[model samples]
Target: MRRLGTFLLGVMLLAGPAFAAPLAVLVEERARSDYADSLPPEGAFEITVKEPPKGEVLTLAEFWMDPRSGKFLANAVLETGDVQRIGGLALITLPVPVPTRRLLPDEIIMEDDLTVMRLPVGRVGAYVETEIEEVIGKQVRRVLTPGRPIQAQSIIHPLVISRGDRVEISFSDGLLALRSPGRALSDAHEGQEVRIVNLISNKTVTGIATGAGTVEIVQ
Candidate 1:
């Protein structure tokens, strides 16, 4: 009788995995559904069921989780219609903006140049840009590799005035206004300061780049 009982226990242990597999899928799906609203479109949760409930669970009736700790509790209905509680932990990933191809400095980021990638929340850093909109229309300040998170300082507004370009320099003190042709000594974006050499006076001065090939001297 002792040997027979031991054989029966071994059979139940062998059958445990078959029951656990289906329950694991259900649990993972429930966790994803519970946090759908907070998740990005391309984001998902990687669930690890620490303990599969010890019962013949037919279906999950309800589920919920703590967003902070990633601890989840589910109310499952057993085959016998009995309600059982199951708990586990999960690791969630979020979408981050990345370049679709290798981008070089001075290249402007277009909609097609950017895409989203899923990364573990802990791996994303504060220096990275999270949204595609944040990168679009911005010019690359440094080389960006494909599928890598873009650093915040890796891009800037497209330069409106390039070095050595002829620009119209304007000076105004409310009462007096004068405009002159000058050459840009440095590349500058809109509203950024640039050094300009006056074509007529043969003198160098600093001014703010107001538009394409245009600089406004304030001082």
Candidate 2:
């Protein structure tokens, strides 16, 4: 048994680069450089080392990538002055915007109400928001949990004019200005088109909501 154990130890020592921490780091750096344009400012890549290169590990001299296959190729210079070809598979991670705290329905989202988190690209849903700017100042449509990615449909622009509210519809062409009383037929955010029913004419018209209770007729 002692001799068998000794033989196993010898074989293990003969195996090069038992731990591939350096190789993992080098692969991550290559991913960062290759995916720089697609990554957000605070975004980063997470590399999972599935297969570590086998050789007398020394230093990674060169690195390149095959983005389509999510594979990385590299050259490791061994102590024997020989270059060893190495390859690895990695999973890329992406950044997404999330709420910083539990947000109640209809609550307005402020800049401080949100945070950013990284998730495996496969874990991010198609409708999840990835940019913070897309969420800030928006109204929460449903409850949001802390550190969880917010779905695109869960947040919306704050409504400036609500349905059934009295609004003033204004039309102006520099030389002429006119205002008409109307009732909002639909809810709308500032600068969004809203359906309004003219109080005097008893007809519905679409206009852009310019402010609180104010709709502008573009033409």
Which candidate has the highest lDDT of all? 1
TM-scores of all candidate predictions against the true structure: 0.62, 0.67
Model 2 agreement with the true structure over 1-219: per-residue lDDT tens digits: 234334443554598543434666666776778776765555455665545545444455677887655677766654444556777666667778878899998899998997777876766778988888889989988899998889999988999999999999999999999999999999999999999999999999999999999999997
For all candidates, the clash counts are 0, 0
Residue-level lDDT tens digits of model 1 in 13-115: 5767324337767876776776778765656677666666566665566678887667888776654445667788766788898989999999999999988
Which runs in model 1 stand beyond 4 Å of their true positions?
1-44, 49-89
Worst 10 residues of 1 by lDDT: 1-10
Instruction: State in Å the error of residue 94, model 1.
Output: 2.2
Residue 56 of model 2: what lDDT? 45
